[model samples]
Target: MNPQALSPRAKRRRRLQQRQTVIYGLLIAGLAVAAAFAYLVFSGTVPSPWTRPITMPEKIETSETMECPPEGAYSVAFGSVKANVFNSSNQQGIAVSVAGTLREYGVTVAEVGNWPKFLRTDGQLQAGKAGIVAAYTLQQVFPTMQVMIDDREDASVDVILGHTYGEQSLIKSGDFPAGVEIVPPAECVPEEEPTEDELNDGGEDLVPEDEETEAPSDGEEDAEA
Candidate 1:
């Protein structure tokens, strides 16, 4: 059984044996890894123990917001314009009071719980992706009140103008208070080329030529002498 004396067939057999041993070892290792992964999947738990009771953030509740009407007595102006506004929507109970004019027809709507976003194309509050949380309850009720844009520097008074909620195209700038006007962003206009008349002629400026001083006539000088 000397190593040097082994035949070619024996050498080939020994090599094959070593290769099979390596393959068997790899196969066992693979099976063990698969088993471990399967266990993780079926355990019905996250890897982290702390994640077991998944925490959800607490939801914020809507609150009341107050805004004054554009005009009239301070006492009479504020309050819910519509009674049903409180009952129907998610709005929080809100009572408006006149704080005074903001700018022209603009008046401050103080104590707004939820910030109002202006929607020019439509008067109604646009539905937010997460849905709107109503923050103000109505003290007065008017289903067909107008919406108007407040010209005030502060954003508190940009109310919808014109027709009420139900009317088709109810919101119009014209419906706003007497002094309030909608100022849309200026649109780009095409630049016009200057006309030929506008160009300077013969080195003379577009401005009127200064009057040239005339040399006194020789005859007039002689007459004076």
Candidate 2:
């Protein structure tokens, strides 16, 4: 039947129905989009933009002692030792004051800042492969601090103070490094690599993660073809 032949009342009713259909379609589409977004947020597959990332430390274990001295030398003097102080705690300006106290012992304070990446309870003494002994030297003062290994390619160690940090040197009354000495360069011990099982079960992947940086299937498809 032609709409031109319809009564005026019928025409008005027909137009109203078409308008209702269009409105219902839009509402359904909107509902679908909202449902999809909610799934992405709750499924843990996609992070919501408004949510602050909760980075509760899943790993913070003491690194194995590699027994390495400074880059080439076996030992270093207290005055010549290099170190950096970091405050990760909520305390204000604690690192700077600690650095000053560190300088009094003739230790070189390279840099000081607040590092929030690795949060701790007491403190952490971090050193690279070449700075093991340097870290050990700093550990003398802060003996209770835990040791962590970093990837820095230098002999400078870092001391990250945590929430309960009120540490001071144990040698407060001595000649400050009473008998510090300079060790000549010798054959340095290499860091032992962690096995695959250790990588899968240990605290943090650390060095193993570097070996697995590339995706596991990058060249596998082509090789299989």
Q: Which prediction has the highest lDDT against the true structure?
A: 2
lDDT of each model, Cα atoms only? 0.32, 0.70
Clashes of each: 23, 0
Model 2 C-alpha lDDT per residue in residues 141-223, reported as the tens digit of each score: 77667556767777777888887776453334454353454242233244567777787785664565557655457556544
Q: Write the per-residue lDDT of candidate 1 for residues 72-112, one digit (tens) a residue.
A: 21222222221111111222332121112212223324332
lDDT of 2 at 210: 50
What CA root-mean-square deviation does each model show from the true structure? 24.5, 22.4
Give stretches of model 2 more than 4 Å off.
1-75, 167-171, 175-225
- Stretches of candidate 1 exceeding 4 Å from the true structure: 45-225
Worst 10 residues of 2 by lDDT: 179-188
| Cα lDDT, model 1, residue 30 | 100
Q: How many backbone clashes does candidate 2 have?
A: 0
